[model samples]
Target: MADKSTNNIELKVLVDKESNKVIFIEPENDFVDVLFSFMTIPMGTIIRLARKHSDPVVIGCMNNLYASVENIDEQKFWIDICKDMLLHPCNAADHHCNLLKLKLDDAEPRRYFMCWYTSSCKFLSYDRNTSSPCHGGVMDREKSLRLDPSQVGNVFVKGEIRFTVTDDLQVIPPIASTNYVFTKLDVMDVDATEELTINIGTVEMLNLLMTSLVSKTPLTETLLKPKQEPKLSSSKIINQAIHIESQMFGDPMDGDEEGKISVKLVVSKSKKMVCYAEAGEDFVSLLFSFLTLPLGFILKNMKDGSLRGCISHLYKTIRDLDGQYMISNHHNEMILDPKLVPGFCYKNSLLGIEETSYYLVNNMLTTDRSLISTEPSQLKVIGKKDDSALGFLKGPAMFVVTDNLVVRPISRILELHILKDLNVPVTDIEDQIVHVGKKEALHLLLSSFLCDSVLTNTFVADLREPKQEQ
Candidate 1:
């Protein structure tokens, strides 16, 4: 017989440790349903609940009822038994028993334990002992019966919230918290629908409401709002001064502003003639192009046009035209003074001159002994001039012209040897005269001099048309 002082709920349940199933829950009640819900609760939460409610209580299951010991070791053993019965088993139906008893103090309400199970089942446990019954615990039986349809967990429903503007064009922003419940509707089975409810604030509500309202307004009305043009400071506005040069040839269609010249042009008018002049970009470009031409080619073209005379003739004319001319060539003829010439000149000395002449003759004989067919007798040194007014000319210079018309300077000693080879007498041989059979006289005519000048002035001009390699 149960103690009359204790309140008890008699439940017939089948428990199988192998299957972890509690079946045939007899006379099921709210407390029993809550307890069943905790069958799958985590072990850690159960351990925490056991620690919180350390008071000894009688728990009955599987035809067995035992007082839960408050001692740590006994409590651990009971917890392991509950865990094995609830979780580790394969099926509770296999180990079913008809009689189970849960006894409680009659002074305490049944809802106390029910609330404990309910709170322990949550992700965060609620303290049933410390909290008021109606405050944090499960709803009472009457309230649970009158539960709202929205409160039901396993129901399917859809709803929308709308904000409408009334007669007043002015709309007061919604201040109340709004909620949106997104649900997957099940047309075939309304009871199996899933829903997720989200609490929204005024901003989110206005954002959703404005989306539809904006679509009704004309787009042009929003676009027509006056936009302020950016104002640039005086410093930011760049003052660009663009100068354009006028062309020599004019395009009649172009405006005067486009053709205006930037460079200054000063044209003087004579008493008998008037000249029109324009010195612009085109004139400067033409001048630069002419300047890029080869100097020899330019001089040749000028001579051909009679704009410039022969260079030698010009030199002679300048010397004759200016009586005080200090410049003269080797032949005592006046020439244009060199703007810059070599600073050192060959020193004139009889011994020095004889040594240099001997060195030159020996070098020539050693290089080409065929210049003199026969050896010459030793010669005496003749009178030499140490005073020569010519700038680059050293006295006793002899010119030798080969058969190929190549003229070169030879020493007087070599000239004497050549004259002796020709069987000419030493007395008849002039120091400056170099007559040889293997050479021709290079005529010093004005036209020849002009040609020579042109050839000398002309730079390397291969001008051979490039032939592609086969």
Candidate 2:
């Protein structure tokens, strides 16, 4: 038999009479279950509690009014203190059990008067329409008037006090409406306007726009993303250093089976730039290294280890020739491959690449390109003995590693004697002089002879003619 002792109630007198140690005992339910039972009541459940100890109703109301204080003891004094407001101006009313009503009269700025209350009840406005009728909308009135302070009538006291006041206080004649007027306010209406109008374009565009709207993304965000900028390659760096571009030319020799490749290599980065061109195989090998790197991004990942292998394959064809860079197909030109022709201007992060290559031989070859020459003049002969005279090729001359006859004036020659180191050929010849008008004829002939094809080494003049073959 389960008894009420299982889960019924608790009552604690708490304090021990002798030692004053208080203890709590529950007769029915635990404190947790009792608290949860109060919390679990379905919402809107009417809890009609009787005056649970009389002062609690006033205390609850006061708690609702001033939530700033927490402890019940702190604000408990206010509940008793507010009773002073209950002193109604009059002790009794004219009718205790009957209802009192208010009606409005025509006034310019309408005002409301404190109509009627029993035993000093407070007057709050209510129009009969039920839904939020707090602001009184009395019918058949021009304006409702505010209650005059003179007729305040001790609101806390009971009274049948009325007055005919001269002026009005602050009150709206007719209350404003809270509900919205009927118009485009439904969810469907707003959503319809937001929908896109699909008449033209395509699904791609529509999907893109939808994505843009949903994500708030922009075209610049996708299209203008930070590009993986290309770097400038070594070949591209060298290519930019070449500006006045000249076209590749073919071998102009009368019966040669191959075409010649001519390209100018700028030797210095200074203002007085010097340039040289080559005729054949020597130019081919030099152009091979130049063509190794294209635009940076194209071959940026190519290993440098591959270059030696590629060059080795080329060396087998040339058989280590000095004047000519050997090529498998003599018909082909150096650095004149169609791939070297830049299709478009490369604009990358590091530097831009722009190169122009055209076939000059195909355009105008037979046209004479030499400067005009004049006839030589005669001078009086003299047996002039020179005490101090300089020999031909007084300084070392610079030449490109090619067959071209180009001589540079030595502003200053290199200190190291490379001819003795490289073991170049020696010549046995006596200096001969021929006088000419306005020209040192001996100097002119020797300079040309030093650059002649018979001279095998690149710069042979600097090597003194081996002491006259004994």
Task: List the candidates' TM-scores in order.
Answer: 0.12, 0.13
For every model shown, the clashing-pair count is: 6, 21
- Score residue 287 of candidate 2 by CA lDDT: 18
Pairing residues by index, what is the TM-score of model 2? 0.13
Top candidate (lDDT): 1
lDDT of 1 by residue, 1-470 (tens): 22243333333322222432321122223212122112212222222232222231111010010111111122222223322222221111101101112211111111111233332221111122333233465422110111122312211111221211111111111232322111111123323332222222222222212121112211111112112211111111111110111122122323333322122211111211101112222222211111112112222222221111122122223234332211112111101221100111112210110110111122121111223356622211111111232212222333332111122343456545544554545444221111111001011111111221111111111211111211
- Candidate that would win on TM-score: 2
Q: Positional deviation of 336 in candidate 2, in angstroms?
A: 15
Task: Put down candidate 2 lDDT per residue, 312-368, tens digits, no spaces.
Answer: 112222122221211112101111111221211111101122222211121111111
Q: What is the lDDT of residue 104 in candidate 1?
A: 13
